[model samples]
Target: MGTCKCHLKLRKPEDAAAACSKVLELDGENMEALKNRAEAHILAERFEQAKQDAHKAHEKDQNDRSVMEMLQRIDRLIKMASRKDYYKVLGVDKLTATARDIKKAYKKLAVQWHPDKNQDNLEEADKMFKEIAEAHDVLGDEEKRGKYDRGEDLNEQPQGHPDPHTMFFQNGGFPGGGGQRFFFRQG
Candidate 1:
């Protein structure tokens, strides 16, 4: 656990994951190990793996706040990835869209995809609503829209924030040997 924490503190999520995995091998039901590994996977942008670990940890302790928070975060990331093309979600042309145009598109889609209006497919509609809202949130704001137009990540990390996905890929940390296929394809 200490080794895992050290690796995480150093922003070496792959190492933390490995250390946590070792602990899990010794005790599959170790809540601490599961929680640590879930966080490590999340830092690595391995949302599915994180979700799995979080689910296990939640099962072990339903009252665990950290576990529940990790699950929620993983779910949000998964939803975001499922509908990554913000322009597509809003049904707007990125190059030609004005703020007004984007707003109109968002409103149209929001009403159609709103979960309350889609009782039979509440889950799907909820996901779509979240995606539409996320798209609009970015495109509606002038500064964020400008950043997006410039090919910058509108959700750019704050200063000194490390991107674990880049680090994981750069260090050849893909789960399987070949590394030919990514576990999670963003967008």
Candidate 2:
């Protein structure tokens, strides 16, 4: 557990996850190991895996605050990832949005969520602003929009463009975005 905590503190989540795995092998019911591994997995961007470990921890001890918090965070991240509807982000109807309408919608959202305009919630606003920009960048381009419409992974990083979605998930999941609801069940 000390090694796991040290690795995690050093931001070496992969190493932390391995250390936690070793602990789990020795003591499967160790809530601390389960929680630590879940945190490590979250840092590693393995939300589904984290959720599994968190569920196990919860089953072992539902009263554990840390375990419950981890479960909630994992649930939120899974929900956010599964609800990647760019059209919904831009407030455009996927089926009927014209290029002009898409552009208009994007502009509106961009202004509304601009960090400069929402200083009190700068981080949240900035995230929303980026999402709007990404949506616009894809929807404004005919080819990219076509691919996105067909359910391709628009979250994939471009050659030189950093992936905001990855950063977003790493930090704490999507702050606030309206889209289709997704449910994940523990099996």
Candidate 3:
């Protein structure tokens, strides 16, 4: 459809997908529509839909070079999705998240999963706490976040992080770490 192609050219991938879907509904076997929709889905990071469309396109024409390339790219993205995603660790959607959001999420999750609070599940808590810290460290910094956004942060840990215990004491035992609670508590 001209609308679909026009939207794609304008870099409005979500619009392109919608337009292409309208054409596909009328003609399921339209190779151009299928291919364009698949591309739009890829740009939107909707891998499952993109995969489906790519497969359909491939079935329609196994010899299509562009479809084959799309299939390969999808496979690669799927694999990358399996990695430990810092955005996911921080419980934020990367597309709409800002630095403040990432920081807020990290603070919340870190406290919830702090090792002292999860003595019965220390191992899991420690792992989760570390993950949250790492997410904040990477995504909270412009340079690291940029590298991470570009997929260069492979298995990277939070840099120069103090041990959990040290961080806790240094911060005064909580986010504000004022140490007032300890003075008033019996435990």
User: What are the TM-scores, per candidate, against the unseen true structure?
Assistant: 0.48, 0.47, 0.50
TM-score of 2: 0.47
Candidate 3: residue pairs that collide: 171-177
For every candidate structure, what is the RMSD over all alpha carbons to the true structure, in angstroms? 20.9, 20.2, 17.6
Question: What would the per-residue lDDT of candidate 2 be over residues 1-187, giving only the tens digit for each residue?
Answer: 8999999999999999999999999999888999999899989989989989999999998788888877877876776567668888888898999999999998888889999999999999999999999889999999889867654555666666557786567656764433447899999
lDDT of 1 at 179: 52
**Alpha carbon lDDT at 3, candidate 1:** 99
Residue 110, candidate 2: C-alpha displacement in angstroms: 11
Query: Which candidate number maximizes TM-score?
Result: 3
Q: By the lDDT metric, which is better: model 2 or model 3?
A: 3
Q: For each candidate, what is the lDDT?
A: 0.86, 0.85, 0.88
Model 2 steric clash pairs: none
